[model samples]
Target: MKLEIAQSTPTAASIAMLVQEHYGLSEVVESEFLRRSFNQVYRLGLTDGRSLVARLSAERPRGAPNLQFEAAALEHWAEAGCRVSRCVPTAGGEIAIEVPLPEGPRALMLFEHLPGEFTGDTALDIEAFARGLAVLHTAGESYAGPESAYRLDLDYLLQRPLQGLLRAPTMTAELRPQFEELGERLQAAILALGELSQVLCHGDAHGSNNFIQIDAQARREAVFFDFDEAGPGCLAYELAVYPWNLHPRTVDGVLSDKAAQQWRHFISAYREARPVPDADLAAIPRFMAARQFWLLGEYAGRIPVWGSQAMPTDYLRRQVTMLRKWETLELPL
Candidate 1:
């Protein structure tokens, strides 16, 4: 189902005009393209020696919280002294604004420039990163604002994605049964684990979504951002997400030994910072499988907005291969 249409970004001139008119950031000296998979992120430099990140959503991670809900979540984190991506509100005190597009309307958002640097090609301290996730989960317990209908549950994870694969025309006939069985097996496995430890999760706490800052004392700390996917979810599932982010750099016919060690270290650190239920630890592999399937469905579902570029032809097959390897994965926990 290649639609032959790729989403286009607005010109720098248009972006400047929109920023000035809406948020009063009139000194936009530069707007550089950062990335554009789920959203279009930009580095906006101002004449006043300030930097900000502007997110122009491509609008395809559907069925999560609305802009208002996310804004509240960020506000809560800020108020609680949790390091998160700070959202810049508009004159009307709103975090998200819609800009007219030829296709329809696209959502836009802005964030204060977080003061830190990312681990570009450096080995990440998996333990330090995990501690930050524990902190995020702890802070979520204190949120008094409106709760989102969304959660990282089966509906959002397995079932919805399974349905997306069903709609994909290119989904192989041979692989269809495999995915169906996999989905059923995953569902049963999740249920067999009984109740998992539940809390508000950062949803996507992978390396790219977090940054490390060094204070005047030269102590390094991790700060998380990209709460667009934040919601109620299992602690195990939250812990499992690290591997998926790591998969790209370390993927093979099997999960590499080094990567598995990193996964172990991260989980151990989470346990050190917060008590992880035994049930959640046992469920991590299944949750990893769930993440893979959900992302496959996500890419398939985004064909309307992003077209064929979203999923490579071999993508699903590779996921199937990864699933096979999951059987042999050995965790220290």
Candidate 2:
């Protein structure tokens, strides 16, 4: 059940207490905040000299389904020969501990710390992601798990966000019509994208989500973690995030020769597993646009915790610039 949540960041000290009390993890040698996005991640070192990663996920008014889906998804991925952070259960027989948020109670799940760090040059790792994504999509097709709380369908990705932005006080009248029209165009493109392949996607598949592990044999493996946003979605849109994330640092331009060359490698690697259809390629821009709008809506939703400064008053303007840049991108990647 959802309860009224107030805007507050869970402190490291308070989270450590929950870890000790609920998870039976005591004698914390050290604890430090890793980063905060959808979840507030912390690194905890123990007296036994073991380290664990704790995630305080009060980002949304989420419940059991969220954690359960993550557990199931991670297990599935791990079994399929990819490395994933396995979920740690609480001492009293729970997969997640309920930590109170200012607005409500949220589930906190501990994970085994995976070794290694994210690498800058991911040529081999990108290939791994491509192949791994194909395997994940296949496994997800036959998954018989309970219904997950997360879904990346058009409603979740586009329509809901479209409504949220319009409802937001931050949305200006000049921008309102533009967003509405853009939303309509994207929606139509999505519809015209008829029969696009669908599967469970690692909703955020950027570099930060995975790690580079070199085995004793000197073979490198790309280990993907964080199943928090994994859910069903169109394959093209899922694939689009790879380039979508690489765009901001675009040296030449989104469609420049340099950018195209960089994106082409990932797409080629992906085809080795399951090739993208011609129609899907044509719809990449629309999906990319959807991701931009969806993020804007997401920022609007997180306004209370992130505040106007963090999310900013000019968030819409930034998004417009972002979408325009994305539009300049070519479909033949």
Candidate 3:
């Protein structure tokens, strides 16, 4: 499958017909702000003064069939007053729509837009965000979706060590050595660790994927978005991402000193929400290292395209440097 990352911008007029057909809305308009990420998000306007979100898949088979699980989870969360975007169900209770594309039929799902500001690098409420994540982790705890058995399994890490390894046509010869070295090191480290602790994680629970609701008085609360990656997984695996996701310093490129500082605030807030088990706590450094290796390996895969850009070059160089630095950190765990 040739996966071209979706960057095509859809207009309101093009989506109006689809929204009206699926949602039975009398009127629909294109959203003003488009979120550019893995998938393109559009703000949907309706005649009844209500708004919804239209998530369009950039590839064919329009939407992944498994995404229905996300709709179910969102429905569950919204009913519990979690401020999640509500999946717009069809009259027969379906939340996903299959749209035809050049490669194949793509999947599109609609959700009621929750009012709030997106919490990115600056002004994110870590404490509140952690609490909300705890709430989500505990939601439908007993309900194991299709990925239940593989929740804590190492298959993804085992089989898919790194992807997009040679996308860049201009990768330097010296960089090849570093990429292969990192990939091998990551695979070995993850394999050495036995079965990991299992938990329902928000999968990609990072700052950008979350929204913060501020009251008239300026008080704030956090709400999670983007359940595309949500599923059962190792608790530590999920927590391990905080250092890179919410910390602006790390985004510029990998930086051990910044990651070290961010982990404290992130973990403290997360602990306040839901205590980390002693076993996972002991494995934080290993998990952190694993996370770094995984990140570097991923970038290596995309080096062909990403390597052409200056930002990715700096980022990759920094990551290579940071991984070496972390080796000497002597984490308490």
Kindly list the per-residue Cα lDDT of model 3 for residues 222-259, writing each as its tens digit: 87777666667778777766654533334234445645
Q: Which candidate is the best by TM-score?
A: 1
Alpha-carbon lDDT, every model: 0.76, 0.73, 0.60
Best by lDDT: 1
lDDT of 2 by residue, 1-333 (tens): 866554557777777777988876657767788888757889888888888888877554222337777787777767777677878778886778777666667778888888877734456766666666676677677766656786787887888888877867777888888778778877876797688877788887766687877789977666677777778778878887777776663223455555566567668877878877887777777787777777777776676767655555476766665565665456565
Model 3: lDDT of residue 174 = 66
Clashes of 3: 13
**Preferred candidate (lDDT higher): 1 or 3:** 1
* Model 2 TM-score, all chains together: 0.88
Clashing pairs in 2: 4-103, 5-103, 6-102, 6-103
* Model 2: worst 10 consecutive residues (lDDT sum): 249-258
- TM-score versus the correct structure, for each prediction: 0.90, 0.88, 0.77
When sorted by lDDT, best at the front, the candidate numbers are 1, 2, 3
**Model 1: per-residue Cα lDDT over 1-333, one tens digit each:** 644334667876577667877886667888777777777777888899988888887756455335776778888988888888878988787777888876667888988878667633333456667777888888889898877768789888889888887678667888888888878878887899899999888887766788887779866678877887888888877877887666552237445667767777777777888998889888887787788877878788788766665665577677676676764454555
